[model samples]
Target: MKRYKKYITPYLSAFVIGPLMMLTEVAGEVMLPKFMSMIINNGVADRNLAYIGKMGALMVLTVLFMAVGGILGAYFSAKASISFTSDMRNDLFQKVQQFSFENIDGYSTGSLVTRLTNDVQQVQNVLMMGLRMALRAPGMFLGALIMAFMMNRQLAVIILIVIPLLLAAIILILKTAFPRFGEMQRRLDRLNSGIQESLTNVRVVKSFVREAHEIEKFSRLNRDLKESSLRALRIVITTMPVMMFAMNVTTLAVVWYGGNIIIAGKMPVGDLTAFTTYIVQILMSLMMLSMVFLQSSRASASMKRINEIFDTEIGLNDDNAKNKDKKVTEGRVEFKNVSFGYSGENGRKDLVLEGISFMAEPGQTIGIIGSTGSGKTSLVQLIPRLYDVTGGEVLVDGVNVKEYSLKHLREGVGMVLQKNVLFSGTIEENLRWGNEDAPMEDVIRFSESAQADPFVKTFKNGYGTEMGQGGVNVSGGQKQRLCIARALLKRPKILILDDSTSAVDTATEAKIRESLYHDLKDTTKIIIAQRISSVQEADQILVLEDGKIIGHGTHEELLKTCETYSEIYTTQIGNQSIGAGEEAAV
Candidate 1:
């Protein structure tokens, strides 16, 4: 509540005005019955036409005021709630953008999406209802109860007994429903995760003919979500029937007790009639109160989830950071006995990269090759401070990476990741992500260097062609080229290609490397590839096994000095030689 004070601060006027306007409705409603009683007992009984007419006009005016109050209350509620959610959603998005990869890994993408969209809506809805009903319901309840007691005290005892019973029931239902609502939200996250995973891997699913399996898996999650939703709402739904029963019982007691009182000459006929109206008002207010409680149960769960994100102290902020305003101009990069792992547990966790020592001089081309799960990707991820080194230090331009601001460090490194992504937009729009101000000539120059220009021009729209979501419209090889071109457009001091060209042919990969060497002569380039041919021409090559660096040298130097490097090169060339002989025979 304290942390969320900022959101309420901007809308304080609306928040105040909405409930105060609703009070006008409450006052009108609570007074109308008393006016009717006066009209009936005095005017109708004594045949006083003047009094009847005067009181009747007052009642009409009150009803009109109530109508105006309701509309105004609704207006303020709308304005306040819409504005609140807008600010909340924007802040949530900015928070996510600032999250380090480590922070992102702490939450699933689907869970975060649910919190941002569905959970926020739950809170928004409750806020709107609270603005309109929070004050009005309680005001009406107390006012009507007081008026009922004034008309006939004995009959009011029924309300005293029944109201407490209903309150107890609401408390009980809410206690059970709160935990159930949290479970239901978790189930919704699971369902969303399933849907996202299935759609993103649709191509693989189709290739394997696994549509039926996917459908079955989805159906199971959907059914779990349905059951969880029903369980939580069943508690909420039960409140309505229990409240209606209490209302009806209270109404019957009022009518029965007041009828006897009037018969005994202890209460007037008109007063008995007014007492019934007050009884109805009291019960209705309780119903509104029960609805408020029910909504609060669900929204309370959402609030906790929302506050969790706000409370998550960003572990990668620039506070207490050295070289906070400094820049990294040179491309030189070094790792000194660097070790990292994904976990942050108290005990020692498995290290993904251990005791790794490496250095790349400015303008050097470094190749990293190893078997799968050999920490090649993880090693480069440390360069951009995506994840901090667990044991030692990573340095760029002779400064510890932790010293430089994240923006400066990342700006100096252009990366085409192992899993590349292009957002939904035109080809030009995606390329401009590296350098938004890049001109047409720069775009063409990089595109040609990436071996992407020829294919791009073949399309009707050329650079303006629309790429569907995640670059779905392009072939794998074409996407690789476009990604390479985008990175080239950045003109970064350090460029990392993490197996980004595996989809292209060996000849095309060779051409890309040639253009990179010629065009980006001063850029420190790191290529992580599985193919020995892809790395053979590099100035330096590293052979990794497990999480350790096992070999390091140039192509000819490694082939003679490192057995692991020699075995890999011999195997790749032997296979290629066999293929060449077979092709010549054919």
Candidate 2:
């Protein structure tokens, strides 16, 4: 709760102004009864019309003061609440961006979305209501009680008895409903997760004809959220009736006891009437305070949940060594006996890469071939320090990658992912993401090299053609080509193509590879592919099985020595084999 101090000043102003507003309300209420008493006992009883007119005008002036104070207090309090919540929303978003991948995995995408939107709204509502009611209700209640006691202590005694009963009712409601509201929020998160998951994979559900199954799963979560909310509402609903009943009983006691005293000549009729108004005022103020407590309990639950994300410490931090000296090499990559596994208490024991050792100098092409899930993508991800190795060190140039600033290490490596993703923009706009100040000549050259220029030119607007979300307007092969061209535009020292050519036909794939080798001879390349044709011309090839490297050599040497490479080569290219001319070039 104290973490929100930065946003508390405005709320504190609302608190201070609230008492002033309520002071005017009490003064107005008290003075109105006095005017009525004067009109009844002095003006009307003495047949004095002149005094009546003066008292009426004084009553109107007090009412005007109360109205002005009420409006000013409401305006400032609303302004403060809105400004506070806006700052909270911005801070929450910034904190979420700072979270590491591991920390983010603890929360589902939908749950985080709900916390940012719905949960924050709940806290905002409470802040506004607290300003309007919290201070005013207490001051009005106590002030009215003091006035009633001064008028006639006998009638005020009923208020003392009734106020405690209302307080007890409020406490009972909060104790039961507060915990239930927390559970309701958790259930809402689950419901949100179910909806998001179903929408993201709607294609899979339709293809498998499992729409009914998905609907049923979502319905179950929705029903649970509804039930939890209803249970909390039932507890809160008890508060209003119980509070009104206590107030009603106290009112009846005041009227009955005051009537007997007036008739017995123990009290005046004017004082008894004023006493009734004060008693009603006290009861109404208590009821408003009870309502504020009910809302505060629910908001307290939401605030705690939001604060949890704000308090999460970022796991990854820049090293002091990187700050002092942040130089990194172009394309010299090395993995020294590196082993890695996902970190958690119940995480898998089987390592993704076990004791893998490799080195590639500048201007060399390293080919990685493996079965699916053989850790090919995982290995290249370490060079840029996307995820640190669980054991051993990854080096660029001669320095440990962790010692270099992440910005310096990533700038030297350009990557094309296995799944092509494009932003919603024109072709020229998308290409500019790789190099902001890239010239048009450079864009055309890379596009031509990656075999994407021909198709791009065929479009009505060419470079200005608009791409839909995720490049949905383009074919898969075209998307892959554009991504490859984008990476090439960076003119990086090390280029990684992770099965990037899979969407294209064999002829196009071969032509692109030939052009890449000829044009990018000076750039170091790491190609991870399932096809033998993609990597046959490389300087060195690595064959991985499970998590270990089983072979490392040239295409001709590996075909003759390594069993896994020989088997893959036989299956892909067949027994026709490479001729003397082809073998020498490969």
Candidate 3:
């Protein structure tokens, strides 16, 4: 409630005025029936044309006033709810942005999307409906009930019996509906996940001829969602008929009992007619109230889910940093007996890298070679504090990396990941992510160093050319080159390339290496690659196997001393010779 005050306080006027306006409609509703009754019982009974004409004019004026009130009520409610939702959505997005990698692992991309969009929509709908009817329905019920009893208490007694029955039915339906709504929302999460995964990888699905498999998978999820929705909605389906039945039965009781009074001359026909209208108003108000409660049940489920996100404990933050003001100035990196792992089921640690220790001085190029799943990427990720070490300390510039704020620590290191990702924007716009205020000359210079400028110039729009989502319009090697260019523009003290150039040819890779060694002579370079040639000239190289470092030396030292390194080098050379011979024969 305290958190929500920020969203509601700014719209306090609309929140108050909306329901107050609805009260005006309630006042007119109660008075109009009496006005109609007067025209019938007084003017028509006495055959007075002037009395009937005056009452008719009053009824017309009351309806016009009610119409104006209803319109204002609706407009204000919508304004308040829409504004509240807009502000809440923005806050929720900011909260998600603050989530650490571990926190994000607790949620899926699609589930977060659902929470930000669908869940907030549910809260908005309830707010809008509640604002309009929260006061109006109860006001109508009380006012109409008072008038009914004043006109004839005998007829109002029948309403008491019908009210309890309707109340019981509504309570039972709501109790059964709440859990079903929760289940339906879970199914919606699964369906959204399926859709997002399929669409994001639609090209891969087609390339592998798995489109049919994906379609069937989607159909299964869709069917499950439909079934869950129907289960939840079946309670609503049962509610409407039950309420209508109770309304009809109550109205019949009023008309039947009141008819006897009118015939016996104990009540006027006009009074009986007015009494029946009040009975309908009372029951209809109950129906409106029931609908509000039903919507509230679903909103409660949504709010519970949203609170989960807000309640999540962010495990990684600089809140306890001993040196929060410290920044990474010199990019000298060292790992001191660092052992890292991810948490698994039952609170167990699944160790990925064990007892790893290394160092790279500023202006040195360190090469890391490993088999698949040997934790090459994991090692470099620690430099940026993307994931913290579980055992020992990682230091940058002789200070613990955890002591630096994440923003400053990451800004000093530039990383190009194995998977290249480009957003939907122009090429120049993408490069600006590295340095938003970079001039055109710097952009072109970095592009040339990355071996991307020649190909980019061939495009009709050059740097202005649009790259489709995820760079789908470009080839794999081009995407990799552009990613390198973006990272190069940052001019960081430490640059880590995690197999970022696997898609490019060996000659182009050599050129890129030469550019880095020549131009960024002072930067610390860490290259993780599979081919030995890629790192043959590196100042030092480390070989990893099964989460442990088995060898460490310069390229020649490793080749002569490390048996594993020697075999890898010999195998790659032999394969290159065989490929050259096959090409000559062709």
Model 1: clashing residue pairs? none
Cα error of candidate 1 at position 359, Å: 1.2
lDDT of each: 0.91, 0.83, 0.91
Q: Write the per-residue lDDT of candidate 1 for residues 1-586, one digit (tens) a residue.
A: 7767788999999989999999999999999999989988999989999999999999999999999999999999989998898899999999989988878877888889999999999999999999989899999999999999888778988889888888899899889999999999899989988998999999999999999999999999999999999999999789889988888888888888788888888887888888889888988898898888888899999888888887787857776559988876889999999998876666456788999998999999999999999999999999988888899999999999888888888888999999989999999999999899999999999999999999999999999999999999999999999999999999999999999999999999999999999999999999999899898888889999999999998999998998998999899999999999999999
The residue-by-residue lDDT of candidate 2 on 250-328, one tens digit each, is 8789999999998998887777777777777788887787777888888888888898898777655465445435554
- TM-score for predicted model 2 compared with the true structure: 0.87
Clash pairs, model 2 backbone: none
lDDT by residue for model 3 (1-586), tens:
9989999999999999999999989999999888888888999999999999988888888999999999999999999999998999998898888898878988988899999999999999999999999999999999999999999999989988888888899999999989999998888889998999999999899999999999899999999999999999999899888888888888888888889888899999888889889988998899898889999999899988898888888767888688777777778999999898877788688889999998899999999998999989988888898888989999999988899888888889999998889999999999988898999999999999999999999999999999999999999999999999999999998999999889999999999999999999989999999999998899889999988899899999999998888999999999999999999999
List clashing residue pairs in candidate 3: none
Measured with C-alpha atoms, the lDDT of residue 493 in candidate 2 is 81
RMSD from true fold, candidate 3: 1.3
